[model samples]
Target: MKRHNAGELPLSAPAGDAKRGLGKEEAAEQGKVDRYGKGRVRWSRLCFLFAVVSTACVVARHCYDAGLGRGNSAAVVRIDAVPGPPRKIIPIARGEPSEEPRHRDPPSPPGDDATSSSSGSDEPDDIDDGAGAASSSKQLPSPSKAAAHGHQQAGHPFARALAAADNKADLCGGQYIYVQELPARFNKDIVQYCDKLSPWTDMCRYTANGGFGPLLRGGKAAFQGAGAGWYDTHEHALDVVFHERIKRYECLTEDASLAAAVFVPVYAGLDVARHLWGNNVSARDELALDLANVLAQRPEWRAMGGRDHFFVAGRTTWDFRRKPGAHAGWGSTLLNLPAVNNMTALVVEASPWHLNDIAIPYSTAFHPASDEDLFFWQDRVRALHRRYLFSFAGLPRPGDAKSIEGRLVDQCKASPACSVMECSTTGPDNKCESPAAVMKLFQSSTFCLLPRGSTDTLRAAFDALLAGCIPVFFHPASAYVQYTWHLPKNHVDYSVYIPEEDVRKNASVEETLRKISPEMVTTMRDNVVGLIPSVTYGDATSRIETTVKDAFDIAVAAVIDKVTKLRRGIVEGRAEEEKLEKYSWKYPLLAQGQKAEDHHEWDPLFN
Candidate 1:
């Protein structure tokens, strides 16, 4: 329960000569250098990364867990669940049940004006849920109180560093959440050993979600109840505290103690009432400005480089997949886009709303996970084929080799510039019979029949382009937002975009292939091969990074990289405070919902 690490740092003690002449300012400065200076920092970092792989010493085991807890500190309890005493669980009384969820932005209660240097408290008023469970002036046992009750051990260096980081960097660095201190209303899955890593939401708390006050101490309705953690706006954060907790406060209020902070990340919903308040407009006007105002803090906070506090990017947006009668809608490949920002990449599965309306409009999946890399081509080609060929022209089923062969045969006969070419006599499972045969058969033709099959990507496009043959795409097209906008659309003028619907609407595959002009095909080929990496993956080709192992590594990396860079940038004078890239509502389906609901996710990035 001690507030500071009086036991001292874990590294080799400095010689008497090292500390001989330094004063307070000098001590702090040297400490900063020891912590983050180039070589010193690198050595220490290597040691930390090594610890992840080599923590075998029993003594080191205890120390490591105590130090490297969650995303908060390098030192804390190990995240791996180790059985220990369970914190006392207090039962929360459920309020009146309503299908309308007990979700709303709660306000923080006023704190005692007096400030405690060590505690750094402008302690919020006790919970006033019609039951004065806590008196505003009630004093706590201080750090010694928990020790007396055997609730906690003395503050070790790990705990100290964790607290220090949380205090100093909560706004932009990391947050420290001692979940056991929370009432049972919170997640029961929290491990006691601290070093465990959990989802961002699990460790993060805000005024909306009964943060800081109610869960810290005192009272019946404080935590074990509904209407908690519904904080809806920035103004409401008037009471949010970082790193430390104080005596009980009002139920569902947005106010709480102020601790050291890095920045506040908001987990927001498209709530209407709070949105109105933020906009300087009244609620019934259907105001979204308030929501924007509250969210603006995220970008503004991050952009300011306020080392003490900053927002994590502008804001993040998410919505459930709307597939009817479907229970599990996992992340669909349709969400991938090249060079898109973090907020746009979501776990949205295909739904009726997107059955045919949405196209995987990404140029490339930036950091292609194995699944994405595989799905990128296969699904894309299949979708295009389904839309343009089978469905559009009512052709034979996808597996009809005879029908496919017949189409190619017809093309050879119909086009004067074409030759009877065969990748295989067998049919659709055909390889480019041989590159030599490909050159002899397709090299003279202005357009080549670029059929995309097992290798879903447009490998045919590559061959056709290289052979001076224009590719007429009936396959999956890369949906990159950047290239399509920046590059010329005629980029594919010589090529053709025979939509799957058009193909379905057509008469015969032979007739379809034969109608295209050789000159047009050649032009299309020119553009496909001339495009940028933004146009394709694999070769016209490929995507991205160290964090590729996580399920959605890009999102996590975005958050981590932004935070790390912002911190380092501030020191280097390279960036403004928060300035995290803002992602528009990237998905058309999502945008449709946003427009319908008069909602937007990238509120912070906008005005």
Candidate 2:
């Protein structure tokens, strides 16, 4: 790929041209930038004037072109169009079975370890396996000869074979991964100050186990699986999974120059959460701004304009894109920053329109430690004798009259067979917050109500899938649209969808669920069980032994695939000014017969 100086930004479009054809839905989206009743900001005409002052073509054109919002401000700017061929869509070989590893005889050591970047540094003192496990160089597996080739070995079959191995080697691949050794302030400093980060909840629980949080209290007995060591942790802590997993990633290398993609391990979500509740935009944005400044100074940023770099944000994309003049918003200005705009961002919930933000699975309960545990849980769920036809586990939101969760809660409460576990509790832990309770609720029910939460989707949907219950979503963004790379292409294969408007006006949740034949429900449950491994973000300690790939593996592979393609495009001067967000794990679901209108729009800003 032809490298560009990061300082040399591409020309941008005029800001005034951003709102040429503004629509009602988009205007409303920009107008009331609600942060789920917290830090709600009203961006009116007056604010537009202020936003114009700070408006650069990069931000304006990106928002407008990406369909996030309309730009009404007369922000001065310049635009440029880099010529390229029409993009040729490439099919990704995901979830395809690969042959077993054919281990080769060790190659002779190189004359001089030119790429041995960490040869002088002391080896790891102790490998963190939750328990203090003594790790030595002899115990650690050496990188395969193919991995030493760095970017050159990206899609090699030998790497794929290693990843397919039924042992610890399953996590090993030939593609070299480099985790940036970011300054302490970006990661540990933020965690050390967790107590002061949030006023509503204690941040300690959310930061445990490298951000996957402490494992659920009672899961080993209920769900039989070996190495449940880190399988089931707090569902909201996705930042931890990415941070720790890459440390043990099979392809990880110490040499940055010998890496296919560079991972910046900054806990952006936890950093911004400290200021989400208060109306202090600068305070909320402090860490992110600092991060951008630090990253910009790095040689890697200049080498590829941040294109070959990536990071994981445990929160939604909206949480990091605080508009210029907005009075309040839940997040910082991380995504909107010029430096970050070029990088691949793996977020739990991504803006459907944002090109660089890839949607990943929200951390959920029932994280299996190994393939044995995964299959055992799947078998139990498949054979579960569900007593209830449906279930809903949430508290009614009294504020929003048209709240989907409120409506679902009411419907479930009224139904004779539906189980309801109202989330009305306080303190560190409660039955409502327990994974056991949540799992039991779904296990006893045939169908689980998965309405839109603060965001388009919630972590509970995966929990339901783990318990062998089929999820019924009101919004397409809730699951079908968001997890295109992780879930199956056909929605009907594992889930049921009833539009919110239809359910609010005429349809009965119970009646709709009952209408489905028992056989179909059984089939859906089986499908859901089969998909558990793909969506579940397992404990970092567990080796992904299942033939089925989990969320973390799929996401990492996708990023590498994307970065490789992007570099190839740049090198050939055929880079398309578009994204592969619409691509799916299999066939595009929309093209498979579902009506476009069925995909109801939802707010990415809410959570």
Candidate with top TM-score is 2
Q: Which candidate tops lDDT?
A: 2
- The lowest-lDDT stretch of 10 consecutive residues in candidate 2 is 125-134
Residue-wise C-alpha lDDT for candidate 1, range 105-205, written one tens digit per residue: 11211221111111323332232121111122223223333223221211111222122222221221122111112222112222121122222222233
Residue 272 Cα positional deviation in candidate 2, in Å, after optimal superposition: 0.8
Error (Å) of candidate 1 at residue 603 is 29
The TM-scores, one per candidate, come to 0.25, 0.67
Q: Which stretches of candidate 2 lie over 4 Å from their true place?
A: 1-174, 219-232, 325-327, 425-430, 540-547, 577-607
lDDT of 2 by residue, 44-126 (tens): 65587677866876686677666556446554444686323211111112223222222222121222121131123233112
* Stretches > 4 Å off in candidate 1: 1-409, 413-417, 420-430, 433-442, 451-457, 474-492, 499-529, 532-607
